[model samples]
Target: MAKSEDFPGKPRNAPTWMSGVGRAPAELPEPNLRVSVKEMLAQQQVNEPAAKQAVADTKVENSQAKVSGKVLETQAPNGVIAEISTTNIRVSPFQPRLSFNETAIEDLANSIASVGLAKPITIRPIGDGIYELVGGERRWRAHKLLGRETITSYVREMDDALAQILALTDNEGQEALTEYERGKSYAKILDSGGERSIRALGRRLGVNHSIVSRCLLLMDLSNEVKAILDTNPGLIGGKRAKDFIEFSNEEPELLLQAVTAMRDEQWTQEHALRWLAKEIASRDQQKTPSKFTDKEISGIGKVRVDGKKVELRCEKTVDAKRLAEHFEAFLKTIDRSLIISE
Candidate 1:
């Protein structure tokens, strides 16, 4: 059965929202049928209890273009030098220089005051109307000292690897790098695959392939040797590090001895090279295999076989399982015909 209102033209079968039974549907909150997970997270983040609980949960912040390049570059774009507000620019966390020279920066500031900045610093936008420094920290400091509101900067969009390399190379071009800093930077570039190969890295660094190779060798120095050099920032150079690494590869113990000698005597590079030569000769004499037994050295263990006999002397401290595995590996390498099986 149907019922009609006797007032102004109204139907009893009118839609629920249109009916005057209660408030209109549009007045109530809409259903979240099409709400996304991100929206749910935002809602949770807004809620006090849910937000607090989320702190303990393992949360992964997945971002795609929030920290993008093309849009950031569009502000200044290629070959465009712009004057960005000083306060808006942030220092780069990836800057290679560990400590700034106060005296040198002061001198630079005085010069800049007299002649003005010769060049603009390089930077890249990192969203939110903020920019990150790519290079020229010294110049940035000078401008900051002068209480200038804004300084000239060249803006570019780059990835972490490219940003790091450019920051490193810019400083390198203007100033020298410590051996540790240079080697580590070179290693980072090589490992990051930013330049792809040694030759490519060399080209960017304005060095020959051999020089690039030697710089990387500095990283192979033992921790003990590095610790000694750390105490004196410029105690040794790249060439010396090359000789040290080669000597260490031949005799690791000799490296420790050489480090002690260098620190105690304050030996120059020439003196150090002479010491390395002597150490290498000494190691060669000791490591020469004897007729009675041949000694095999490895990371795991040192073995001496008694004239092709079953007698074996193992010196390295190793677990029983590891020793057994090493023995099995050695056995596998032997000619199969030499084995007698049932």
Candidate 2:
């Protein structure tokens, strides 16, 4: 069963459909086989009236239809769980998952094929006969994978911000979700104004502040690196993302090269890190500057001397004739022979 604190701002009486939080699916009650003579008489007396009342109740329920458009609906505690057409159900734009594991989804499809869907997906009616998924996307995909036309869904009411929060919370800590993807979701939640700050967001999500802070560091990555993550999020782990971000700032070009190699050559993060280290070390070893001497002459600006060549940068107000005469006398004092042809 879901506790109110599980969803910080959720209504007290609302049904909890979020993954791993809600009450167990209700079970059908066993039928009473034995009948008493007096009980049978009493049941017969009320059956007619009960039938009439049920008809009236259904009319009211239909008037205030639980979900828009036509869907086979079953009532739950506070909402309706329906068998909705898979085509009409769309993934939420606020969904945090960037990629899905096909093999895992196939395994799920096989399991569902064997035992049926254990839990229905949660969604919200988005009008025009469309519904937006809130959780259980894997199940939805499995259903699609099986070519099932309709899927069991629990339809509820929630806005984009709440949907995002629920989506993030539902997928957090799952084995398939990469830390880079998690960090990206965190950035979206923060950008959406769902939380005022990282601490507040962590408190709301029941996540540790340090973990959240470390994850947020991935957002500082360059756009190119982020694009790489968009396709291959598992390239770097959350713990490594912090170190990677540092390297990206300190050695941007090298980081890009390493990440590009990871994408193209299918290099592991460990391999990429090792390659980056070797390249940086090799670069440092190969860097050696040419020997030259620079001196600032009092009123004649600066002079630079290399083995056989000397350059004089004259001051703004120095007379050209005076500068030439000064260099002529200065050249005569040199111990080595001067090349004066030019």
Q: In model 1, where do residues sit more than 4 Å from their true spots?
A: 1-79, 227-233, 250-267, 271-342
Q: Can you give the TM-score per candidate against the true fold?
A: 0.52, 0.65
| lDDT of candidates 1 onward, in order | 0.69, 0.77
For candidate 2, the 10 contiguous residues with the lowest summed lDDT are 60-69
Which lDDT tens digits does candidate 2 get at residues 1-342? Answer: 765475767666545654557677778999878964334434534665664354335532322334532333555544566667889898878777788889999999999999888777888887777888888888899999999988877777776778888888777644457777778888888898988899998988898988888877887989989898888888888566777888888898899999999989998888888888888888887795556788998977888988788888889988878989987998778876464455
* Stretch of 10 with least lDDT, candidate 1: 65-74
What does the lDDT come to for candidate 2? 0.77
